[model samples]
Target: MNIDIYSPDAYTTGIPHEQFKWLRDNDPIHWHAHPEGGGYWVVSRHADVITVSRDFKTFSAEQGFVLVDDLPGDILDMARNQLLGMDPPKHSPLRRAVITRFTSRRLEQLEPAIREIARGMMETARNIGEVNFVESLAGDLPTAVIGSLLDIPRDMWPQMRRWSDLQTSASDPDLGGTPEEVNNASIEMGTYGFQLACERKDSGADDLISLLINQEVEGESVSEAEFASLFVQIAVAGNETTRGLISSGMYELIQRPELYRQLEQNPDLIPGAVEEMLRWTCPLHYFRRTATADAEIAGQAIAQGDKVVMLYSAANFDERVFDNPMEFNIHRDSNPHLAFGHGIHLCLGANLARLEARIFLEEFFREFGGIELTGEPAFIRSNMVHGFKQMPVRLLPR
Candidate 1:
């Protein structure tokens, strides 16, 4: 089949699974041309993706900064500070420091706050009766959770979500503005975070921002500028991916009523169902890594400095790794989907996202007797973010 994997339009209706399947079967390490000029290698198979993710020395996230399109020099410098775009040694110490805030114990302690947020949103949903799920319900919990963690004012929560949406979904017309506006949003958000870090320094406050600002990562405290980038990473990552997980997961469950009822009846199965949703939704499509040395992946020649992208959406459904890969099975015995990615740069908030999702599902089923699609769900126009931009749904309160 003809393929235009780079085009945002290709993914608007849904994931171009057919093209991905074709690439996986025929050209697992396919070379695709970039819009700017040179091309990049797309790694489709699960094993190959894991291989690239693990061997960071071979494929360096810091080199190209994890996007298909290269950022400008100044922007690239700031992007490198993000945990998503850092190499080891530097990446390790910082990841260790920040990860402490997202540890299982911490997430467990934070569960009540997260549950309260979810329940409140569900209550609002019940009152609304019919509304866009993405805007009204699904986006609130993550935004609020991140806000609470940073001790951001409740009033600024909407602006936080707006900044995150502009940065991550710039390809979506409804959600994003002009390229200049997108760049400005990043700058504004970073500036706000930088100011926060400066204000919180040495204050001995207990919020996540203060903890990060005061604590010594590797015998040195985090600088305000570094914290600015880190803040952008955490806020954007927390907002976009979790929102996608919750909204798209609900959309999937809404489509399968029997499965939905099954999950509602047996809430214990919700966690497993969340896994299925992660596998099915696969929030972010791909993250690019530049090769440090010459390499060969799946017998395909990969020269030094070649852009190699691990296609998570494709790898999650690899025929070798998953049986009946296309089908969504909550009870699938073994699921090692790369939704949060793999290896050293694996998402720091992975467990927290899981906690949020599980609670969101539990509270959702508890608050609403039933939910039906009021209109066809509309996907955001972006190759990177896989989610519903608008899902109009009517809720029946129990």
Candidate 2:
């Protein structure tokens, strides 16, 4: 079956459910020729996505950074070392260092601070009856939280958001720039991180960046360049993905007010509601992995070095996995959503993202009795980052 999953046009209408439905029914592991030279296998079924993610030895993230199109050599190298890209032995120790700080105990301690930030954001939105939900409210909250964690100056939060926005919005005509522009932004951010690391190394501040700089990993401290790359990854990844969750979650809730009211009436349902929101509006559409050896997935033969993309958005809505997959149910019980992904390469900041979303929603509804879109919301044009680009909303103060 000739599939055109790589075309940005196919995703313009959103998720391409019809195409995915066809793939799931006829060819769960379908191949499509890439417009940019190589081809990739599109993994549609939930079971296959889980299988591929679990069998990391066969499907390597390090082969190529998780995108349908191959990246430049330098960028590819940087991606290979990121927590999302590393395989086995190298991945373990770096992940361990950061995972320690992201533990449940640490998250619990950070709750009050996160809630305070959420409350403040809502208060600011409450003061202004009408605001761009994506910009005025949802966008900056994640940056502030992540910035605080990394000991980054609050004044630079907007710059961090700008860099992240540019990096992720590859399909938006206004935001998308030439490859040189993107690379320049990466360099600028990395330079900034290196400068910060140097200061932390000399001054010896007790913060996440300081810890990362000083702490030994596998008998040696993380190199300056590695630290810079890691810094960019954390700041950009944390900000973009969490922002998508907040903005997209609110958009979906307002569209399905019955479910929204259920959550508002029963605050206890917020956690499950967040999971359902993630299922319905999965922040990332897909992540790519390259086959390291010849393998058969779901009965389809995949050759070595062939690119494979796990369609998480489609998996979340897989009929076989999620009953009533299309419905936005706040009370969804067995929502085994792939929003945070799965297996060894699962999202490291999943807990923090969930906590941010739950608290943000609670505070939002508490401050505003109702949220309505003042105008038609706009979606980000990228096939990768699936979420709202602009959401003009009115906050009816309680």
C-alpha root-mean-square deviation, candidate 1: 0.9
lDDT tens per residue, model 1, 123-150: 8778879989988888888998999999
| Tens-digit per-residue lDDT, 108-188, candidate 2 | 999999999889888887898899898888887898899989989889998888777777776677566778878777778
Best by TM-score: 1
Stretches off by above 4 angstroms in model 1 are none
- The weakest ten consecutive residues by lDDT in model 2 span 1-10
lDDT scores in order: 0.92, 0.85
Worst 10 residues of 1 by lDDT: 70-79
For model 1, what is the C-alpha lDDT against the true structure? 0.92
